[model samples]
Target: MTEDSSQAEHVAGTEHASVADRAAGGKAARAQTPLNSHRGWSPAEDRPDPVALLEEQNLTRVPDLVPVRHGRMMASPFTFYRGGAKIMATDLKDTPRAGLIVQLCGDAHLSNFGVFASPERNLLFDLNDFDETLPGPFEYDVLRMTASFTIAARNNGFSSSDIREVTLEAVRSYREAMIQFSGMRTLDIWYARMSEQELLAAMDMARANQKGKAARKASKALEKNALKNAAKARSRDSMQALAKLAEFVDGHYRIISQPPIVIPVRELAETFGLTAEETEAAVRDQLKAYRQTLQDDRRRLLERFDVVDVAHKVVGVGSVGNRAFIVLLQGRDEQDPLFLQVKEATASVLEDHLPKSIFEQPGERVVQGQRMMQAASDIFLGWTRGMQADRYLYWRQLRDMKGSVVVEAMVPMGMTFYAHACGWTLARAHARSGDPIAIAAYLGGSDKFDRAVTDFAHRYADQNDADYQAFLDAVRTGRLVARGGV
Candidate 1:
């Protein structure tokens, strides 16, 4: 592989280059070339089918990752391919692109953005998950983000013109924010972010003035669930909300009671070289890993808390077939429980387009990159490896004041609020990992990039529909082997 090419199979000195990077890197560097011009590989032997890729894995290797009985729940053909992150990534791998390889939220669907509580007890909002975040052409993120916007608009019965306006607004905000950052001092851009006070005050002004339908909608929503509500949710209601999903396995969902989620903790003990009585030691090791993930100051405060209950719980569609666990900690009292998530690590879809790290662990890139990108991130956010056969990252809280707007429930203003939120957070994320000023300068004082993404979004939405149909065809023809054990 060409040493200069980011995703060239990571060969040290091989001649084979990634299909996208074979270009001498001039026009692409100038951001003048169309990104999709590099169709990486469309080999006939590559299957070109997402379902096939999902079927090829042993499902049991990362048993915690897979849904317990998805096949049966997915009885209808339409929902069968739901939450298939790897499948989606594999399909995209059929075509790779070139240009500025900032880290991407590989599957940047509109629904993935949300609000969650930070360790400082503030209700901070940003991109809520990064299971698929990795470095690749920034365009992939734009493409994915816009595609989700259109898909969401269509689902909400918006006219084409209205949908276009909403999505164009999203891209415009991102482009403009990047430009704004470019003119700032380097360190200013480094620390630049949309603060909670900034958001709350803006909503207050919007509410007082009735700026527009979108702003009014957002103000009303925020007013209904203000900081007081957030505080209650983070501290008082989090465990109850999590327990809502649990069942009475002999009174409660304890390790010995639940088979799968609890079963793995024992395996964790064995994998980490600890005995049954050395429970504190094993848990302490995981806490260390979690601490190292936080920014220095936050780690010190975490050192004081005593971990209370830890459990394995199934979570998320794209991550259904991956390992996910939660650890609850009590600092001063039982009321102060902090929940942390440890998700499995897997190869990135952008792996074929990003630089190889000396670190062999797969998901470290995602967890670290996510923290870097997010303006205000979960302090409990961190990663660990060697315990669950493969590596994984640990992050805090499942539903500690964490919430997302339902696509169907979105009104026009809600869409605008969501779009603006995405734009602001995306710019912040890009700033954290790359030269945001350069990106800002590239996008200065124009809607050209915004319009380009809207155009690309329209075209790619059609492509997603086609891909969705392709998935349906695979199911109809019995090409996709499934256990149907929902």
Candidate 2:
């Protein structure tokens, strides 16, 4: 595909150009990069002080939020504060040497990895969530991932030494793996994946105490159907959501409507300068985009469901402020329904660092990126442009079987297995989109680079903790309002 193949499929665009040639061919396309997209912010002043930018953007305090999973504790504002990619190094300003950085899942924490069914009916596990996903220095993903381990360990009340050890373990794994990726035959890295049994055995061998037990338990569970059967998977996905929708109090999902759901912010039409008719039409318009994004089967599937109700539901820690909504459409039969999540795709943080990104549309990057990184992706994954809005990307079904390992729960032994899985998944993802041979070759036959990065990770993790605290201080001291997901 030519560097211009955003217009075509993922085939090598215009024959495989060297990195330099590809960069030059991609120059005109850089407009898609978020760093260059928004011109209003004063770069000279703001870019220098990410700390100040955090305050200025009012990114410090967060609001109350719920976990997408059932039975997990409600994530605190502190959790969001830590989860926010805003804190991830604005750019890879300073770091150790890694030959090249690919398009990274910028905020790739352990929790962000999961298994999802692809449109082709493959159930592949990789980076499952991409809200903060953007193309930037690969180290940014590393730093963020390592820091998350630190924070998670802290939350779990692990000792400083334990945190340090786990942090080192995770970073060491990535660094070593990347070096391995650097030297691989290209095909090897592309085909890499961690078998559950292999991983469980590794965890047992590492035997970090309780972590090992957890890994053993997870192993038993995964073995039943690590790859879910379609009938059961689809039925399970459909049933739980349909059950919840019945109790929705005007766009709010309630198992039985025990508490009033957060009414769509738009219910107060005054704020949006619209009347009831206009608001109704706006919801319909959102659904229209949803309708256009479906597959032939999905379209046919939706034929059973008419638009019953629509409401903008806020989602995620980093994405809390963006325009996100849920369209509740029901089939002719009361039990049949579909939930489509319409999330506003804004400029990505990786835009600046990703060449050829300039000319691409931001919303398109989201869909395109998700497809590239995820081995298996949601069938509903599709994008649409809107007249009233800049452009809105629609992909439905975020919460089905979307369970994940709580990073904080990783026991010592499980930490080892967890690190291996994350490394294997991340390596596979890079191999999918990049030249993994050079990456694997770079580290050929040694864990030296991994050890170095692990050291760097510990030091950088300290910086992240400091940064996280600074944010909390900014909010508490009234520098930022600390909006949504409190």
Candidate 3:
């Protein structure tokens, strides 16, 4: 057997072990890799060049849009970190591990967690992005999450003490929540989710604890802002997307052209030396294949719609340059619209240092990993191979009441509250796929893991700053090209 596979098998062997045995194994792991061992970061002398790693990713992405990705990453250290998952994955491979494995949100930074519509149409908060999801050591997600909080807080001009407190609270919440999940029934853990009502209640409790007039006023403002954001999210469905992207053309709705960022399929057909009809036929065939991946009811529902227009669109800081297309479909009439986004799925960044995914198709790996980790995933989530060789893609609703917190505008209290929420949510996700009993036992009732990870987060943020400077230097010297303010 391959060494990577063997290591994975060794770590995963306790899956069916008794509770007592699992807990014992966790304690044994503590002896071998102490909780405090996760306390620091020092890049190895032979660490790969961060800029080089990014450029390597650019090799697979659209050439013209690659500069946009570079520009996004050049905005700040936090943006760079968001786009530097591959670089971090390389560095994390050499870090201490307890051998406890779980389905990782390989890029589990703060912005990746958000509120979205559940299949039930209720608003729920959970991990929203799974582009880099994979199975690996649980600490990988935890450390990446904590470091994101640190970097975001620094960007917001938070005090060092406040930043540390926010980061520490996030890990503490995860550790404590995992311990709680350890005692719950398997089905109960599966059913657990953070609904909008629960979130509002938590906010109310925080507001009640405020001391003085100014603090109370600020807390109330934060609560008000959250409600406004939720209301905005509710308005961000396919209709909203249609209004923004489609226009009446030749007696039918068609996607409007916005050069570079959003170009209609006709424009792309010419660029690729194909007739417009041929391009549409190929897209329709691909959509048919993607439809087969959906459930019977969803597939029937999709059958009610007809493709109106398709456009290539740029999306996300890290996902820019990747092939992402938005398809506008009309249900009964022009007003009834559904927007589906087809995004290219490359191999997980974690694959280099961990065992390759069991699923052969990269798109299926993302779809399956997302289904395993999320309490409620997008109903339209599915995968298909693109017409081009070596291309795999996944499809989902372009927008379904999706919203994220403005980390840049957050105050200390708001950020700490967010940290706690993300921590608990992440633990619940991990518990669904990992042995919570063993992980909780390893963490114990102490804050050792929390403190150690928080320390590591600060150090990692420093490393990120150094890497950001290197990237900026590369751009300035024309080693890399960047188009900012996109």
Best by lDDT: 3
TM-score of 3: 0.97
Candidate 2 accuracy as TM-score: 0.73
Per-residue lDDT tens digits for candidate 2, residues 435-458, read 444344443345554555555555
Query: Can you write out model 3's per-residue Cα lDDT over 267-381, one digit (the tens) per residue?
Result: 8997667799999899899889999999999999999999988999999999999999999999989999999999999999999998888889999989988998899999999
Alpha-carbon TM-score of each model against the true structure: 0.75, 0.73, 0.97
Best by TM-score: 3
Better of 1 and 3 by lDDT: 3
Prediction 1 global C-alpha lDDT: 0.59
**Candidate 2, run of 10 with poorest lDDT:** 65-74
- Tell me the tens digit of each residue's lDDT in model 1 across 341-363: 66776766556434554346665
